[model samples]
Every structure is written in C-alpha cells, then in structure tokens.
Target: MRLTALLASLALAGCATQAAAPPQPAPKPAPVRAGLDPSFELDAFPSTYRPASSEPVAIVNATILTAAGPRIDAGVLLIRDGKVAAVGRDVAVPAGVHVIDARGRWVTPGIIDPHSHIGVGSSPGEANGDGSNESGPNAAGIWVEHAVWPQDPMFERALAAGVTTTMILPGSANLFNGRTVTLKTVPALSPQAMKVPGAPYGLKIACGENPTGGGPGKPGTRAGGMLGYRTTFAAAAAYADQVREYRRKKDAGQPAQPPRRDLALETVAAALEGRAKVHIHCYRADEMLQMIDLSHEFGFKIAAFHHALEAFKIAPVLAREGIPVVTWAGDWSGYKMEAYDSVMENAAFVQAAGGMAAMHSDNVMLMQHLNHEAARAMTAGNEAGLRVTPEDAIRWLTLNPARILGIDGQTGSLEPGKAADVVLWSADPFSVYSQPDLVFVDGALMHDRARPPERPRSDFELGAQRRPEASR
Candidate 1:
C-alpha cells in the first residue's frame, strides 16, 4: 500500500512541473561598442630604434661634470651594457673592463638640443631640401619624423660636437606647426631608427610674428593669432569631450559611437589631455603672458618656450608656473621688432629667478656649437655678477634641455643606471678652444677625433666627394 501511494505522489509532482510557466528568454549581452580605430592611435607609428652595441669600459683620472651634482675631480666613470654603471671619485672597475686613461680630460653628459631642424631642413639648400614648414598655418596633423632625411650630414657634425640627442621640431611658420620628434644623433637610414625610444611627442605652437605673417589665409595680427589659437583649442576640447563620453559609456556596458577621428584635433586633444607636450615659440613678454593665459583658459600646460627672448621679463611667472625657457645664449636679436629687446643675460636672469633655462641651437650650424652657446651664456651671467660655474652651465647643455625634452630619466646626466651618453673634451668644455675629443652615445663610441671615419656617414657627402672639381 505504501509503494502505491509513493507512485501516485511522483505522478502529481510531474504534472505540477509540466504546468509551470514557460521560462523567460535569456537576456542579450549589451551591444558591443566599437572603440577608436587602431590606426587612429597616437602611437600608430611606433619607434623602431635600438641602441648601438656597447662594451664594458672605464675612464679614470678625469674631471667629471655629472650635471646632477657637483663636479668630481679625479673621477672614474664606468659604462656597461649601454648604461652608466658607476660614476664617482673611486668607482671600482671590473678586472676585464677596458680602462681609458683620461688624464687632463673633461667628461660630461652628452649634450641635448631642445630645439633643432637638422633632418627636416637638410643641407645643400636645394629646392626640395626643406620639409619643415607646411603650406598652411595649421599643421597639427603633420609629424616632423615622417619628413626627416636621416642622411643629413648635420647629424654627424652635431655628434662630433657632443650632441647625442636633439628634438627636431617643425618650423614655426604656423599657428600649430606640428608634432616634434626627438632623435638620437645616429647615422641611420630611417628616422624611425634614430628616434629616441619611448620619448614623448611635442606639439609646436607658434605665437607673435611668425604665425601672424606666416602666409596667405593666416592670422595677420597678434589678436588674430590669439583668436586662431582659441578657436582651434575650443574644437580640440570639444572633441576631447566626445572621446571621454564615448569611453565612459563603453565602460558602463552601453552602446556609443566613437567620435569621427580628426588627426589635427587628435594632436591638440592629446596636448589638452597632457598626453603630449606643448612647445610654444614666443618672443615678447606680453605674448608669453597671453600664452600663459591661453593655457589656463584651455586647461593645458606649456612645456617650454623656444626662442624666448623676453623670458627674463617674466622669469618669476615662468618659474611659478614651472615652465622652462629654451633660448639662445648670445645676443641673437635686432633682426625683428619682437626680438629687438633681447638681452644677453636672459638665461642668467631666468636662473636667478629660480626658473629653468637652457640653450637651444635653432640653426643647423649652431647645433654643432651648443657648448659654445652655453659658454657665452655663462660668461654673460658672470659679467652680470652672477656666479655661474662650469657645473651650473653644463646643465644648460645636458640636463636642462633634457628636462625640457622629457627624457631626463633615461639620459641627460652621468648618473648610475642612466644611458651612457657622454663626451670627453680635450680641455675645459666652456673654453672656445675646447673640442670634443671623443663622443659616446649609449656607451657606443660614435665619434673619435683621432680615428675619424674614412668615409662620410651621409650618402650626400659621398656624392659630393666624388663630384668632379669643376662641379665643385
């Protein structure tokens, strides 16, 4: 009887399950929102640079200007695997390392030029030689690296002058010239090969006379220039907002369309986001203040001012805002009205006001003599009653410029664990007669005065050498 009752209960349970309501349809996954195209990414053209092979070596009995600290006399600098292994008065060298007897020589960190146009504005001065200036005044989409002619002979000349790295910027003939590329002054076939790996990109913005009188359709007055900047930055900010909103919606599992990508706006938006550095070419103090106001209005930071002839006038303002000035050393003024008020002690005055200052070679010829530029600035500072030593001035050539270029962590000084980009000078580096006896980039002996290259590094140089005497 109990077994018959259990069978009846099982039948009832089966009937109740069949009577249950149909299950609800499975919820569909949130529609996938497409992200920005990979091609539109800022790093689409990634760096392919690799440091040259380096060897373990040591140099002893030298006067070392570390750039990060006080100079060391009778110092020792050790290089291993492309990085500085040790630097001090008593650094111990490994038994198998090759030691250089650097008696009476001066060693310092390799020079870095914050502003240059070497590869873009190449030598020979032919019709097609210059690719630095674009036809239009707004060229935010352009990248200087794409037009760099690595065969420019100026690179070798700059290397011989102890310039291991340089920021090759676009000519300031536009409101927004373009993106700047930092390159290792190496003899490579392509700009990508000479590009400094992982270096941040810089946007070249111009103020004052250059952009105002750039060309047809450009802003014709200073106020017009400011209006142009305001207009462009406003668009960039709006685009940035769209990007942020798209990202936010995507993160929240909602469907959102990616904004139409604009390469010009992309670079400016990157600057607005602080993902890229802003390097403005401003001359007058009033314009610099206007730029500062513009930066505040748009919520971006100016990395450094190039050719800041009136930087001394607003040194305190620049220092308080943490902006650096990349200017010429000597009196390179009077050609233009805006440049007429420049003083030789600009760098010294800026430094005295607790602002960062550096010497930049804007000309190709000047790039080969950045050390002399710093020397001139040092002399001017001394003449002005400011005690600027070799130790202090070396920073203008090496570390301060490096800071402006945003590569101080990797190089710019002879610190342990930094890139072994160093130079050996025959005498006091500040003296006009002093020359780089040897130059090393990433611990690779790239230039040696004693054993110069038998053939030219640039193909153009080779062609010129082979030309007939009449052609010359």
Candidate 2:
C-alpha cells in the first residue's frame, strides 16, 4: 500500500511539473507569394479582403446587362461562394437563397475604372496630395500601392458610382511613373486589404510632352524622351541578363554571386519580360505611333494609352496592335496642342475600328459619373451615324476597363466563375437621374442606398458635415 501511494504521488508530481513548464511557440508559417521570382515576391502582403456575404443570393426580375453578352430582359442573376454562379433569363433560383426583387429595376456588372489616382493622389492643392514625382525622370522603383491611402474619401464616392474595381496609378510626372495597383472599391483600413487578388501589375510609361521639361540633361524633345527610354531599358536588360545567369549557374550546382538588385531596373526588367502590362499616358497620334515604335524597340508591349486625344486618328493602328485606348468621354478641346484633337467620338471611333475603348475619368469629379460619361460618348457616336448600343456603352464602363487591367476573367462581367461584383440600379444605368440602389463586391452587399450607414466615410471626413465653428 505504501509503494502504491508513492507511485501515484510520483505520477501526480510529474503531471504537475509538465503543466508548470512554459509552452513551446508554434513554428512560423511559410510566406505566401505569387511566384518564386524574388523580384516579384518581397513579402507576404496578403489581402485581408473578407467577403461580406458567402451565402447564395439571387437578384431576380431585372433588366440585366451581362457586359460580356447580350442584355436579358426580366433576367435572374445568381451568386454563390463569392462568385457569379449563373446569370441569364433562364437562371433558376435555388431554395434557401436570399432573393432581391428587382421588378422595376436594372442590374449590371459593376463599373471598372481603367485609369485613376484616387488613393495615391489624396487631395488637390495639398502638399502631400501627389503620389510620387521625386527628383528623377526615372522613378520606377516605387509602387503606387505603397503610396495608397485606403481611407481616401474618393473611394467611397467611386463606390457610390458603381465603381467596383479601379486601377490606381502614379501620376505621369516621370518617364516611368511606377507600378499601378488594382483594388476592390471596398472600405478597408489598409491598401493590401483592398488589393484585387491575382491582378497583374501595371507599369506606367509616358510619351510626348509630359516627360520633357526643356531643361539641361532633361528629355526636352520627343527624340530625347526616346533616347532616355532606350538607355534605361538597355541597362535594365543587362541587369536581367546577369540575374538570369546567376540563377542558371546556381541551379547547375556552381557557386555564383547573385547580381545586386536595382528596384528601378527590376521594374523595367519585368516590363521587358511581359510580366507587367504597359500603360502609356499619350495624347497625340504621332506620339502614340512613336511610343509604339519605342515599345517594339524595347520588345515590350503597350497594353493601353490613357487620355489619347488623337486616338481616333490611330484607331485602326491600335486595333491591329491589340492595344486598348482609355480616354475621356467628352472632356476635351483647347487645353493644349496635344489636347486640341480630342473628340467626343474618340471612344466610339475606336470601338467601331475593332479596338477596345474605355471611358476613363482622369479627374476625381469625372470618375463618379463614368456611366454618364459613357452615355455622352454613346450619344455622340449615334448622332454621328455610328451604331453604338447601350450594351456596347456599358461594356466601355465595365469589360473594356477590366480587360485593360487584365482582370476580365475575374470581376468585369456577369459570368459564371467570375467574382460577383454587381450593381442594382433604380433606373436605366445611363440615365442621369439613376443611382445605384445596391452595390455588391465579391457577393457581399457593400452598399445599400436604403441604409445610409452602409455608405462609409473616411477617417478624415468624420464629422465633416457639421459646422466647423460649432465643433471648435
């Protein structure tokens, strides 16, 4: 009995000792990155975007504009698992799915802005409002996402305008402005939290007068601008060659020192490799042609040309090259020599010539009415004896911009296997009086006009409506 008691006491004492000791920390998880290329994957800046809804939802009896297909009258759209499950007139609503009646309403895929500077350019006339024009003609090392202020009030205004996705780019102050970031227009604390998952990085380039300051050692002319691009690209190509050789030698079990990384050259190398889409801020048609030549010289493709005032002149060329033109709807004329040729029919002419044309709002005020802007372009085209349908105009605001950002497969159109970014309108989406009654991002009801609180405001704008004297 003494031995038995002694053994039990020993077991209890051992258990107590084990419990008193500090616990071991769990092993850190491996980093998440898009690829094995160190240049692309710096850290695990994972998206913190949580969908507001994961359950099945149905929006029925509405005039649906699929963006990718013909419009459906009295149609039904289905959402499940944060994606568009099905969309058409014959789509059946399954049991237990939350239904949104749209008997007298219209439904369309959410709008996409191809060129914008909402987050990075915080406010006009403010000291820190600019994104990056810091001390060099070539500042490709910086990324616009890093400069994004997610709490910018412009994002909420864009959401109110049915802008589900936007490409926030650096201003065209440098020859290479930097990387552009695509984000979902959801209210979030961090830019990473708002990043559109799997979206391609965009490299902003410039042509014509933007980069030329006519100063000493500056790209004062178009010829000098081309020379600047060529010199920088040659250096970048050499760096890329050295890096590739190092990787090759290492893979073959040879000891080789890796080349020192240059962030500016790294961005340029990515563009040369066709990993980053090129967006050039060009206006005149001649400059556009010169840029096309420059792209050929560098062996990189230009994905789109923003604010191409003379795009109508090069519509056929752009169409043949498979490059998109992102331009304003009717905001043109007499601002500069380059801006003099801008016509309201630029978008229409581009579309008619078999090129993708998107109506982009370069200004903050213009972005909020992109649909109306598209309407004006459509009207101009129709009045000029062109056949521009409402569906075609809707595509200008939706699919074309999505294509420009290289995210058409995900959220641009109302199709199966795409993200359920949708908007329900109180009337025809193009109508000036029409407003979004409900907006959804990735199957989540992000904004409902009936609920005022659903519309989010920025931290800076909190209590902004009250009289300043009273608050003080």
Candidate 3:
C-alpha cells in the first residue's frame, strides 16, 4: 500500500477506536488548595554551573571594542573576582593584579553563537553518537542537554576561537524537536556543568521543507505542516484551559479533579505562558510571515528565526514585529529550494531595516571562525553601499547573539558589572591572519594559544592515538 494511504488508514483506525470507547469518569482527588501538583516540575534538570576560579588580571595597551559603543585605543581592561572591574583608557591598574601588556593586540567581548549543535551532534559522527533528533515529528518533551556529550572536542576548539557561550539546539528534522540549552564554552564532565546558570530555555520549532520532508506518518506537505502546528497548539490551548479550570476550582474550595499531565502539552503551555523562548528555523519570507501570524494567534513572542536565508526579503516586516534574524554570514544557497534566495548581505539588510541581526554557526567547522564570518558579512555590506563598521560587525558575533539567547544582561559587552568574558587577539580580529592569543570566561583564563593544552580535553581522543610499537 502507498504510504499516504497507510497513514490515512491508521488515522481512521485511531478515530474509530476513540469513538467506540465508552465515556469514563474523571479522577477526583482529595480537595487541597496548598500549591500545584508535584508532577508539574518544569526544571527537573537544573543547572549546577559555577564560574571557574579567577584572580585579578589587567590587560593593558590594547585596542578594545566593547560591542556596546565605539572602539577604545590603548585601553586597559581590569578583571576582578570574575567580573569586569573597569575598562577604558584612563583606568588605573592596581599593584596586586597580574598585568599583561597586549601591545598591538585587539580586545573585545567573547563571542556567543545563538545557534549550534556541537555536543548533541558530536564530531566523528558515529551512528550511536548522534542524538540531535528523536523518531517522531513532535518531541517537545525531550531536552537536548540530555543528549549532549560533554566530551565533544569541538567545545575546546570553539573556545580557542573565542566562543565563550553557545546554545546547543536540536536538529531541524521535526516540526517541534525539543528544548535548547545554553552553555559556556568551558571544559566539563557533564552538560549541567557547562550550562549557563539561570539562562532561559528555548523551544525549537521548524518551518518549510525540513519538518515536512519525511514521507510516512508525518506532514508530507507545507499545508499539512501548518495543519499539524495548528492542531497541536489547539490541543495545548485546551490543556492550558483544563489546568486553569482545575486550579480555579481548587482555589474556590470546591471539589476538583486534577488534570492529567501531558509532557508535550506542558512544554507548549510553557511557551504560551512566556516562560520558554520560541525559536523557529525558517528560511522563506512568506513562511516567516505566516509564522508571525501564528505567533499572534497563540499570543507568544518569537525569540529568533535561525538560518533565515531569505530574511532580507522581509527585513522591514521582521523589524516591525521585533524578531531578530540569526543567519549565516556568507551567501550559502542553492543546496535546497528554500535556501535558494540567500544573499551575502542578509545580516546587513536586517540591520539596515532597524531590526536586530546576528550570525550563527550551524556547522561545527564554521563555529571555529565566527569572527571571520562577521568580517565576510561586513565586507559584503560595505561593498553594497551600507555603512557597516567593525564595531557593528563585532556586535553580530558578541552582543547581538547574547541578546538573542536572553543573556545579554550578564555577559555580552565589556561593561563594568558584566561577567569578564573577554578575548585578546593577536592582531585585528577582523583580519584573516588574526587569532585569539588569550580567552577568558567569567575572568578565568580558559584558553591561551601561546600555551596550548598538552592533553586532549575529550576522552575519545585519549587512547585513539596510535601507540609507538616496541622495536624488536
């Protein structure tokens, strides 16, 4: 039988079974109005991250770009107790602080990538190692962090490239894949240790070809995909209403039946309640507009649209809706029908339209050179007669992504009160020849190119090396 026909028959069988079942009474629990039920625990895997120990260190005589404003030449940045104590040209360096004269070097806030799949889709791709997606279309109950391999060697590579923070997201195979976890680019034994404490979780949703491409038992067309989203969200709305009614009855001292918990609906309800941020993976302009309308219908805000290749086509609309575009820096297109209309100036166009724009590394290889990506975008924008500056381009990799991940208040720019996540470059960071000489996360020295790690940070790399055979 054809796949579509088989799916249709299964649906009919499910409907007939539901109709033939007799109506059952709802379970009534003992009336008590103290608090919510114990089964509704949202944060079952809370972050246990703690900043690494660091001492007072002062970096002097470097050109600094704060990502918040103009550049500072010959400036001094002081780090104390894992925080930026002072940063400017006239800042005084105390006697006890360890000072390094970074002559001819550049300093900026550590880079942050809002979209990445490094740990979940770890390197040397083995069949058993890949855990970026589940079997079904809607796996909203699953958390990507649970599948994250803390030993992924890419984490240390990204750290060497000045990536201080990143969000490990599920792949875009399903319509509603799972939750996203934000992590600091620090070496650790577990995802919880790498996670950025107090960072809000993001729900990953996809539009266009990715979610509907699967043949059987899935949305096989664009309209079908839309229907699936609407139906699922409608169920989520009903679930929310049922929970609210139960709580209302309980508050009024009336006998109430507790609503049965559904993990998928619980995740959707959290998005509806403005607790989890909604991030969609969309490419086409029309689909983005449709998603905006859907967001309006559901009364939820979109945090960002990742891999938005055609975002330049509707820059003003996105600006009006206050949705940021997290896109690639170069013109990467034609690989798929939806990504065919990409432009190198997509990020610049969004920024020109008075909207927020940021660059992301959807590939593990690309994650190692996000600064170069920003440089490419800036060069493309400048060639197109846009007044894009190094300072502005720097924000695309630093402050802008931090804003997208909802962690800008803590670690985006070189502010006095923010976390001392800073990087010192060998030369102009935008230059291709430049490299990070020193990288710091929350004031701790995490990576130093001058003194590389002698031992592999990943356990997979430990015994994989060929041992020297004993000579006869």
RMSD to the hidden true structure, all candidates: 4.0, 10.2, 14.7
Ranking by lDDT: 1, 3, 2
| lDDT string, candidate 2, 273-342, tens digits | 9888989999999989988888898799888999998999989999999989999874578877778777
Worst 10 residues of 2 by lDDT: 28-37
Better of 2 and 3 by TM-score: 3
- The positional error of residue 193 in candidate 3, measured at the CA in angstroms, is 0.9
lDDT of each: 0.89, 0.85, 0.89
- lDDT of the structure predicted as candidate 3: 0.89
Q: Cα deviation in Å at residue 201, candidate 2?
A: 0.6
Q: Candidate 3 lDDT, tens digit per residue, 327-441?
A: 9974889999999989899999999999999999987889999999999999999999877999999999999999988999999899999999999999999999999999999
Residue 146 lDDT in candidate 3: 88
What are the runs in model 2 whose C-alpha is more than 4 Å off?
1-46, 124-127, 215-217, 454-456, 463-472
